[model samples]
Target: MSMSYIDKNYIYAVSRIRYAELRLLDGSVFDRLIEAKDVAECITILAEKGFGGEYRDPEGMLGYEKSRLWELIAELVPDMSVFDVFRLQNDYSNLKAAIKESALDLDIPGIYSQEAVADPMLIKQAVRERRYKELPLEMADIAELCHELFLRTGDGQLCDIMIDRAAMEAILRAAEASKEPVLIEYSRLTVGASDIKIAVRAMLTGKDDEFLRRALAPCPLLDTELLIRAALSGMDELCAYLMNTDFKDAVTELRKSLAAFEKYCDDLIIERLGTQKWNSFGLGPIAAYILARETEIRSVRILLTAKQNGFSAESIRERMRRTYV
Candidate 1:
């Protein structure tokens, strides 16, 4: 779990990942899904690809794929903690949902993700009982803070932002501590992109400086203070700032819409993951495979949603996230 992922120990794991990567859904498979007459047909096509394997609903099949992906990685690695960077967001999401449920005195198990390191039930109980110690260290204080903040201010939006920032912060710390270059870059992209999203949303929603400051998480890839200044001014200022950074390409998507910008961000992450496929050793390929599967699962979910909702294939084809395959 230390920063020693680039050695012989990972060779076999990388080999397994290499084979696993081959099974990742390519464009042709996605095409089949899109062309399928209905959601059931899509699952049938998925089965042909070894994904729609179990006879479950679309959501259940996707859940099975995600669980199967994680199980494969855990089987290959000696320590799973190094992979915490990938799971942190889900943990925080569960925390956020738990806090909301606590405030409302409600229980909604469906809101919790199964992919997180933290158990959803534990988080629900911790928040409901006001027992912060029951949560992870990175989440404990923030959980308590958001739990009480919602009760005090009745501002669910504020609580959401705080929890999100906390999630970004925790993820960055985990990535940097791992000392994996790909992991580090992945973390930076996540944090920086998230910051831009917050900034853009602030500009679009008339959020004040206090909200922007509270929402943005620090990323070494960009100047945080400058981002705040630009966001406070307007979209032009924000786009101008983004144009000068490594994320200059994001400027066009930023101009389009938040959804387009988000899709661009996801595709960029996949572009980063692309390099891992050529790697024959170390954790990069395994890590990349994890993300690749995530992208694949997410895209499949999107496609299924489009099918269920009668969304046009053209609309989805334009925004479907790039796959690692």
Candidate 2:
């Protein structure tokens, strides 16, 4: 095997990330996070751990914490220019908040704060003013699309589906553009896994075909109709449907518990990305390293929450994703 395809920069980037991952595994950080009573205390503790960033508000610290964590990692890796991806994910989340506010017709400040964008007011103004391109990422464009869907159907569910669909489309596009096998594989795996989750949830919820179509995200790997049909049938049928796909290895674990299955899938994806021997110069290795860190942070949060909530380690393990460990 000629390692000619490997980029030297990616290798260096991964090396740096491996060091950062070690820092995240520190027990003291988790102890501090677990000791925090409220969101403010958590933020303060995290700030002490070098999590510096301007959060939106006290109540929304959960989202702010995740957003800021990603931002810090982005700052660490200038080669990874996917701040827009994180911003857009936040925007999608914020758009959900915005629509909820619009539905309640309530006065909600810090709407933009929910979004990771620097000037959410500007993004909101852009959408309110109908500048879809100015939104943020391809996902932001989906949020804009959701606004139109909201106006047309008056169904919040449809708007949510539209945004999800747009995201799937964007990820598929990104996967296509990714020069490395790791990102392309990760993106495809993400789309497929997401479709499985949607199918399983739909089957459990007893939603109708129309709702399923409107609710399910459209991705390149799985056909929407197949998901709807499997969902309408049963879990066995759904599992059988996915068994032939690349994710068949997950079906056995998922059959035990949906939460476990989800965790398993996440670990698989993270492991797949983290193990790839990409060189450090390009966006590929950095993106993988960043996502890996985010996974570890979320895992720690889950552990802390579980400990605080009195959930057993077994129960917590069901929902825990694989980390650098």
Candidate 3:
């Protein structure tokens, strides 16, 4: 931790982010995106709003946007220490993408090929060369970890569970290491939401005990064994089990649709993160701000897709994540 926590550099960075956020429309942009009939029209509208990237090609736009934002974040926090919280997630995403390629018997490829890892051949060669040693410190064991996960989980829902569990564990551990109250709270809320989602899916599908166990993501708030047991028991049992948790409000809705429940959880996380960004100290505020921006971008994309697909306004609204700002 740097002793100069409230220096001019930090203040300047925060002010720039605040100004950038203010330039974004609250709900008006979302409304426009939801009404866009085609990709071109959506891109034109985005350009009009100062999101002037390569709109003729969506992939190029994604790359450009990701690069621009990441560059800004780097400039804001030159040491990259503040973004370490995301290292675990980046490692996990890279591994998952590799596993997906392996499962299909294709060469290891990056899912976000444009922004990072543009060449599939290069990724394959790196894995063949045991090049984990050449990667970032946090990513050193990621290749091996992904391989192990695939061997163990075999591309089933459990694969998702394993990766999410690892991510949650990392967040909790990092929170502990930093002794940041906001991080701890955020980790607990995220894990609790995840548990709720898992429980709902298990109860709805009548999955096996083994499956439930394999699908569970490890979190600080939930006793994994007890949660699996409750999920296997019944929906009523699962709901009862979550009596004291943060996601109790979601239980009733979860009974209807797991997808909806999951979306609700995501919106809640984004909202909470946005709120934290306003009051956070040290690097936490910057990290939270980045998450909020990423989340907003996702929301806009979702809206655009929905509109282009001809979904109704009510349907689009239903799918929109709650705005934290």
Instruction: Give the local distance difference test score of model 2.
Output: 0.64
Residue-by-residue lDDT tens digits, candidate 3, 198-258: 6667677787877766656677777778788888888788778777566777777677777
Candidate 1: which pairs clash?
Answer: 46-52
Tens digits of lDDT, candidate 1, 216-283: 99899989999999998888998999999979999999899898999999999889879888888788
Give each model's whole-structure lDDT: 0.88, 0.64, 0.65
Error of 3 at 293 (Å): 0.9
RMSD of each: 2.2, 5.6, 3.9
Error of 2 at 244 (Å): 0.3
Residue 192's C-alpha lDDT in candidate 2?
76
Which is superior by TM-score, 1 or 2? 1
User: What are the models' TM-scores?
Assistant: 0.95, 0.75, 0.80
Off by over 4 Å in 1: 1-8
